[model samples]
Target: MTVDRSMIRVKAMLIAPNEDTSAHAVTLNVPTAENPEGYHRLIGGSVEFGETHREAVRREVHEELGAAVEDLELLATIENIFHIDEVLGHEIVFLYSGRLDPLPAEAGATLTESDGSVVPVVWRSVKDDADPLPLYPTGTQDWVSAALTRQRP
Candidate 1:
């Protein structure tokens, strides 16, 4: 039998720290007419054809966040498989840790998507248990925890 691999998507994501390194920057998914009950997610996007994971991460950040990142270090590669609206979805995720010069202010910044949706990029403490914001792509919390611990003195 022939195999169909069209369902698999490759995504590159970044874990970026705030200026003080106290928290990481994440996008608050604004609910649209199409998708209500929005969620939070890291800043990155799909890897385009002929693009390296690092290159994709940099390009995505510039497109989404309007900033350039440096010293990208691959932290994790996650095989994410789940169902969205009863449709099976799979993604090969490349997670990277990097530093952004002149990081955005504590008030955060706004990113406008191609579809004209405004997404807020904010810094949140990874260790905050009181905040009940839902972060996506399953296994991301564990990766953040480990990254933070590694940066500790």
Candidate 2:
């Protein structure tokens, strides 16, 4: 397969056994250089030179949660057009799903950029359409819809 260089980011929707595959949602505030509220950032990153999509997903999860994924399943590949608020004009997010049954007890995860910061992780239902949800790249609606409808992973 020919890898496209245009969209250069990868992410994983780290999930656990929820209420029969309930809606899985997590919060991440993107920190501003100056802000009183203080924000959170999602778990994700760009693809490295010698990394595959699966590897990137694992790396991101470890960086964010300080845990390695023992069970990961591909849900779907959804292409999206994103108007990024952090980086370039657009990015294509490669979505993957992994199971983190017993959540890690560590206080934080390590990152090459942030030098390792502590962030909280949570699990929520994604099946509720009426409820407001927070997505990482902001263009994840298509991916979410695809994941919820696909076969059990």
Clashing pairs in 1: none
Q: Which candidate is the best by lDDT?
A: 1
* Candidate 1 regions with alpha-carbon error over 4 angstroms: 1-6, 31-37, 151-153
Q: What does candidate 2's lDDT look like per residue over 1-153, in tens digits? A: 233445544444443333355544354344443323433233455666788877887776666556576557665554445433333434555666555534542334233333444445444445535444345555455455555566443
TM-scores for every candidate against the unseen true structure: 0.82, 0.59
Candidate 1 local Cα displacement, residue 75, angstroms: 0.7
**Residue 55 CA error for candidate 1 (Å)?**
0.4
> Candidate 1 on 1-153: residue-level lDDT in tens?
222344898989988887556788888876544346766788888899999999999998888777899878899898888655445668899998888765766785877765667788888787857456767676887777667667521
CA lDDT, every prediction? 0.77, 0.50
Where does candidate 2 stray beyond 4 Å? Answer: 1-20, 23-25, 30-42, 84-88, 104-119, 138-153
